[model samples]
Target: MKYVILIHSNPDPWGHPTSRYTAEGRALSEEQHEQGDRAFDALLEEISASGELVTGEALADPASSTVHTWTPEGHLATDGPYAETKEQLAGFFLIDCASRQRAEELAAQFAGPGSVVELRPAMWSGGDDQ
Candidate 1:
């Protein structure tokens, strides 16, 4: 089975979870920052070594995002993000696993103090050679 892990968080100066910029996220010292970085790196390495990581990436700032829609008159374009919320979609990981339980286990590592990780199965678009 193939799964996609969606990461979400509020816009942070240093970045979500890592909180490299904010004093609170820094936890009053550089030690917290380094530890957070290592934890994330370790998670990636663990998944990669297990051969479950297909691909993953962090997204750019949400303010730079754009939205498009069709109106009765014509097509419309607008600045995004379209949703109003404290948290926003930040990134994702694509993984191939043997079962949903396995995928869930992998996604658990990404759940942090200020971040949310969502696991969803990838669906085929049809017209496949299979």
Candidate 2:
């Protein structure tokens, strides 16, 4: 089975992976940062070695995102996400797992404090023809 894991968290707490703000933002202690990094690395290694990791990527800050809506007239573009929420999608992992339980386990491990991981099965895959 295939699953997409959506990673959500407050950007203020950790910023983007490449962000330079460590103190002005929701600053995590140095130790917390190191531990989180190690855990994430370990999880990725485990999944890759198990041949479950199809692909993964971390997203840019939500501030850079755009939302589009369709009106009776035409499409309209807007700034930011479609909804306002404390947690923004930070990243995602696409994995081929043996079962939902396995996928849930991976998602649980991927999610950290104040973060959420959502595992959803793809309704239609890229290669599938309707």
TM-score for each candidate, following the candidate numbering: 0.81, 0.81
- Kindly give the stretch of ten consecutive residues in candidate 2 with the minimal lDDT sum: 17-26
lDDT value, residue 40 of candidate 1: 81
- Model 2 regions more than 4 Å off: 18-28, 125-130
Compared with the true structure, the alpha-carbon lDDT of candidate 1 equals 0.77
lDDT of 2 at 19: 23
Off by over 4 Å in 1: 14-18, 21-24, 126-130
In each prediction, how many residue pairs overlap at the backbone (N, C-alpha, C within less than 3 A)?
Answer: 1, 0
